[model samples]
Target: MTTSAIKPLTVLFFFLAVSLRGTNGEPCGTSSIQVQTINTGETAAGGDSVFEVQVKNLCPCSVRNVRVDGGGFATTVGVDETMFRPVDGGVYLVNSGEPIPSMGAVSFRYAWDHFFQMTPRSLEVDGQC
Candidate 1:
């Protein structure tokens, strides 16, 4: 084949190889949300304290349907009241309803009321099939 023809074929093969190697559609993995403090060790009768949780997308691909559960706390308060609620809480559902880019992260702050107790929080992030 002519040198010019060979060049195009080589370029095409290279492009395909690179694209295949790119990170995409990876499986969901567990990533810890850094909790500054798990518990304050103080309980009030009618007051609340703020807590912070970090959610990270550790997968090589984007993640979607991210849901965070307060774990043991949820069972105590029930599902309706267990969702994270803070006046200025950073934890929230991604409104875009799209994938969280790989390695991207978001922080959430929640107000734990007297009725709510601090517990290990778990995050469930769904990925595209």
Candidate 2:
């Protein structure tokens, strides 16, 4: 294609990409999900154990589907979103319910038959801001 023709197409693509991020050029929290695993002594070997999963959003924008894939079956003790489930092989995915603001953190606990092994996390937000 001609250079001039390509320029307009490139511009259009750029705009579309920005719009999906957020409004008013706020940008999107595309890759800003932090996961913190805390060990709590609530059980013995192969016994019931408790753990805390802390998820934080370190982006200037927002993110969704803040999933934490931890090994073993678990129960959500506390969290803003109710869209949490076990995917496979003891991995769990949780929806943040809403966008997580920059530096905002969401914490939840789980009780399982084994220790905690979390991988790949996401984020959510706080009160309206």
Candidate 3:
């Protein structure tokens, strides 16, 4: 083949190869999680109180061995266990052996009687593979 024809064919082949690859130019071995609150409810302490957490996988591979912690209510008196098992699938109870699929989401709910009176506490939900 002539030089001009060969060069064009080489470029076209290279482009096709790159494009056919999954997520071309996307960084591999990278993942992310997004957490959000979905709902709230009234507490017995005459205040609005409830906890919801959403965990999302933003990676190409599945995440395994996920654990959540720090979902405790902090009050002037002291910290207490106000979190409970998810009444629904949106709220995920702790599962040490389950694997979170790639690009998946899980959520759960928690309630507190004196959430407002408590010292604005935060929950730390973590996941691992």
Question: After TM-score superposition, what is the CA distance of residue 16 in candidate 1 from its true location, in Å?
Answer: 21
Ranking by lDDT: 2, 1, 3
RMSD of each: 10.1, 8.0, 10.4
Candidate 2 per-residue lDDT, tens place, 1-129, comes to: 999999999999988776555554444433456777777876534565777677777665555556666655455344334545665566566652555557777776666665466666434433332
- Candidate lDDT scores, in order, read 0.44, 0.60, 0.43
Ranking by TM-score: 2, 3, 1
Q: Point out the higher-scoring one by TM-score: 2 or 3.
A: 2
lDDT of 2 at 97: 55
Give lDDT: candidate 3, residue 118: 15
Candidate 3 lDDT, 23-123, residue by residue in tens: 54432222244455544564525354665555565655565444343345232222222322332223323333255566777655455543321111122
lDDT leader: 2
Q: What TM-score should be assigned to candidate 3?
A: 0.41
What C-alpha lDDT does candidate 2 achieve relative to the native structure?
0.60
Q: Please, what are the lDDT tens digits per residue for candidate 1 over residues 1-129? A: 999999999999877655533334224433422223343454334345544444555555666545443433322221222223421233334323345666676544444552233332333455342
Q: Please provide TM-scores, in order, for all candidate models, with all chains considered together.
A: 0.39, 0.50, 0.41
The weakest ten consecutive residues by lDDT in model 3 span 116-125
Model 3 RMSD in angstroms? 10.4
Name the best candidate (by TM-score): 2
